[model samples]
Target: MNALSDPEPQRSIDVAAVSALDEPNRRRLYDYVSGRGGPATRDEASDALQIPRQTAAFHLDKLADVGLLDVEFERRTGRSGPGAGRPAKLYRRAERDIRVNLPERSYELAGQLLAQAVDEAESSGESPRTVLARLASQLGHDIGHQTGGSDRQLLETLERCGYEPRVEADDIALVNCPFHKLARTHRQLVCGMNLHLVDGLVTAAECPQRHARLDPRDGYCCVRIGTTTD
Candidate 1:
């Protein structure tokens, strides 16, 4: 699935998973397991790291519990059935990409959107900017649809997209821009895309009275959601 359509649980970083690495032993064990090309048993990790088997097992299990590691069971002796000995528990790095950012950023999502826009523009002989606006709008529409397409849920949907919406009188101002860094360097392109994105969201949510426009205020998103009168 596209990054935008990924299940919320998969796209978001697990705070507990990041916290598990704060422990020195657990961090070291995680690094060792991640560096290994294949799964490592507790005994192998303890021997390589010069730690007690029990300690290694505890750290490894903690990592697995937090979804930082994937666990499996197998017989190392290349045998199965009775008398072949019990299966050894093994640990390997989880395939999920875990990222933690203060205030939460969606640079990866922005990258994917820009890349797709470029590809589509090249194939269809359309301006990259034009294609980008369309893509962003469509994505916003999908998001609004997913949130039940109601005016009341607009703030919730925007928050989930990292917009950090704030209500001021009749207008809703976005306090955080998910593509803040990108917008600084490519203000026109990023802000235009942001405007179309919110436009699509407002349209799909059936909030016809609300309009998204480029207000470009300091310390806020370039696009502001205001009523038709504004």
Candidate 2:
């Protein structure tokens, strides 16, 4: 099939929003509370989501179960309402220190691979920005085929793959390459290894390119994906 015609539904998504979310309703709950970390009542979430109270409650329960949302007891209303006797339950995005432990082999391999990307970019006279843009496109394709309808999923997947992504707002995000930074700083064995790992991931993900060669002048990469903006 023509590359243009190829369907990668998972591309250009945000991965973080998808994490800890398996069901659509549960995922919707996360998006609702995003940026608003504070607690909300069942009626509040239901109104915000425009869903039935029962449906909202069902999704909220699931989110709480996964530790994605924090649950607490608080007064709903008083005298004429349910709060006359005891407090009601509330929900919020769980804000606690979360530690992600990578396996020894994955870390060692990721470190080595990121190192290589830097060396190769340096050798070819290309800026790290250009190299990473190519890396992003490759990741876009990998993400596209796995799922669609959310940029959040794409971003999260890239982060999991070792890219440090920053969400600027609802849609746009940037990923800074630590390996490239290391290369620019230390410029040693690690840089070269990192490049290889990125390239390998692109290939394994079956992106447009089998390898990501550098193109220095433009400070941008060649693995193009269809988008409204660069």
Candidate 3:
């Protein structure tokens, strides 16, 4: 499915999983279990972390509850059928990437969108850069349309997407770049895509008085919204 056509659903990280790491003991247990690369039993966790068996079990359960760890029941004693004892609970790191960023950035979403665009372009024998710019613009237009066709609404949409828009004398500057890491490595490509994105937002919002320009600064996004020279 075209990500640009889909509704921009805000992706939420597991806060409870992050908060669970605040506990020193639980953090230690998590570190140990995660490094092992294999499912760890409560007893193994207790021995490795030097915590009581019951304590390890409790913290491990908490990790599982918040989806930081995956839990499964198994019989490691090599006894299965007949009179085998109860299955032991094993814990392993969940197959999840947890990221917590201030202001709720959606870099992963943007990255996925870009990746999909590139893949589609490759399959269709089209210019990847052209396809990427088009996809980014459509996404920005969709977001702006959802926000309402106004300059204020466009800025709000950008802020929500982690541009960190700040109003200057006669222009709006982006204090934070949502694709900062990618922009550093792929400056021209990412910046070009960002420029088209902001332009599409301005167009969709019917704000012809202001247009997006590529004005690179030391610690800000490359794209800026300013009064049109025309």
Best model per TM-score: 1
Highest lDDT: which candidate?
1
TM-score of model number 2: 0.35
- C-alpha root-mean-square deviation, candidate 3: 16.0
Candidate 3: segments with Cα more than 4 A from true spot = 1-98
What is the RMSD of candidate 1?
17.5
Off by over 4 Å in 2: 1-20, 78-83, 97-230
Quality of model 2 by C-alpha lDDT? 0.50
* Tens-digit lDDT track of model 1 for 108-169: 88899999999999999999999999999998898767665455688888878877787778
Ranking by lDDT: 1, 3, 2
Clashes of each: 0, 33, 0
Q: How do the predictions measure up, each by TM-score? A: 0.56, 0.35, 0.55
lDDT of 1 at 189: 94
Q: Candidate 1's C-alpha lDDT? A: 0.83
What are the clashing pairs of model 3?
Answer: none
Candidate 3, overall lDDT? 0.79
Candidate 2, poorest ten consecutive residues by summed lDDT: 215-224
